[model samples]
Target chain A: MNIELRLFARYREATGVDHERICSAAETISELREVLLARGDHWLVLADERLCCARNQTLCSLDSALCDGDEVALFPPMTGG
Target chain B: MATYITNEAIAAGQRLDALAPSHAAGAVVSFTGYVRDHNLGEAVSTLYLEHYPGMTERALAALEIDAYARWPLLAVDIIHRVGELTLGDVIVFVAVASAHRQAAFEAASYLMDQLKTHIPLWKRECHTASTTPVWLIPH
Candidate 1:
């Protein structure tokens, strides 16, 4: 399955890219993070337990399942007013 | 009820007036958040805000709906500004109207708190005087 990964804030800065299209066999967000983390230290931002995840723009747990073509966003906690 | 996330400056007075009570409502409360000149001892020159387009609106509308379910609110309006902002710029505005002051005040507070950490917006501050900029997350 292929999923669109979106990065925001410091996560984007660290990754040096705002978005990416990844073809993966991972089924859940946690598994997806592990696959990305295998790349290198630049992907270490995903290691932060405080980091937040959203599946298709709605907040979801890391265990949330993913489908092909789903949009997944990863970022630090929100700081809006 | 109306919720907006825009890159343009917000007109607080006009928004407040639009939410003005028509009949039984007796109180209207509002809260505005501003960008400070400094953060954690660093002199900030500018703050840039970003959000997830479709998700941001959905989160905000969910917040508004939550507020209505928790209080006796007659009306509600939330306006949040994104893009580049300088010191003293208004970053957000929240208003709530109800038949009494308590409900209005409480609902306004609830909306602001939820918007702070629940919304998808992110803020990054640049300090021209310093060598590096800072990216801040919700506390």
Candidate 2:
């Protein structure tokens, strides 16, 4: 299975792209982060922790099961007032 | 509280519209935050606002829930704008209606405090004079 991943803010700068994909069927946000970091060492700093994930616009947990067409976004904490 | 969420975000949040009678509550309180042209000793050209799509909405909903729990509120409307924003734009708006002035005032205060500390959003300061904009993260 493949999942669409989105990066925001500093994460986007380090990786040089806004989105990515992982060829896996895991049901955890942690797994997705690993793939991002594995693609390049740039994302390694955030690999240890679960960056924020949105499974189809809804907040997802490490255990949040995803399907084939779900949209997953990874971003730093929000800062708007 | 009434404006639609357009992709375009005002550097500051939107102003609360003239709310008509939604309820018979006697009080209405509002607070609007803006970007000050200067922060500390630096001149701020503009400030950018960003927020977690999921976490931001969740945090905001949670704040609303808390406000209802502690006060006898009749109505509440909280709307926050995202994306790149400039100075003097409305960043947040909190309005409350209650039977009396006390509840409306208290709930309004509580809502602002919660949004500042609880919401998963950050503000970036763009000092045109600086090399790069500073990302303001929560502590």
Candidate 3:
């Protein structure tokens, strides 16, 4: 499945890019996160325990199922009011 | 209920006035958050706010819905600013209208507290002396 991955704030700055369209065989949000984490050290920001995930613009848990062409966003905990 | 995410300045008074008039809307409450000059014991010069465009609106709208679900709310409006912001600039505005003051006040407080850590927005504080901007972590 192909997933549209989005990074914001510190995550984006750590990776030096805001988005990526990656092909993955993962079936869940956590699986896809592992795929990215295996890439290299720069992706280490995603390993943060405080990281948040969203599927198709709505906040979801890592156990959430993934689908083809799904939009997945990963970012740190929100600091805005 | 309405949610807006824009870099433009938010007019709190105008937003309050735009709420639909209702005989039951006997009370209105609002909370406006501003960019402060200091954070983490540093003198901050500016604040840089960023958010996921479409996702941000959806998140805020969801908050508005939740506020209504939890309270007897007549209307809700959430306005948040993005991009570069200087000290004293308004960063967020949350308004709630209800049939009574208790509901209006409680709903407004609930919305603000939930918004602090529930949305996609992030804030980076630029210090007066440091070249690097520090990303803020909500407490």
On lDDT, the candidate that comes out on top is: 1
RMSD after CA superposition, every candidate: 1.3, 3.8, 1.4
> Please, what are the lDDT tens digits per residue for candidate 1 over residues B88-111?
888999999999999999999889
lDDT of 3: 0.90
Q: Which pairs of residues collide in model 1?
A: none
DockQ score of the complex predicted as candidate 1:
0.86
Better of 1 and 2 by lDDT: 1
Candidates 2 and 3 compared by lDDT, better number: 3
lDDT by candidate, in order shown: 0.90, 0.68, 0.90
Span of ten consecutive residues with least summed lDDT in model 3 chain B: B15-24
Candidate 2 per-residue C-alpha lDDT over B1-139 given as tens digits, one digit per residue, 9 for 90 to 100: 3322324543322344443245677888877776778876788888766665565676677677788899987777777766666787777777887888998898888887777755656677889789698876555
Candidate 2: regions farther than 4 A off: A48-50, B1-17, B20-23, B38-42, B51-71, B113-122
Docking class of 2: acceptable
Error in Å for residue B94 of model 2: 1.8
Give the winner by DockQ: 2 or 3: 3
Which candidate tops DockQ?
A: 3
Report the error of model 3 at residue A37, Å. Answer: 1.5
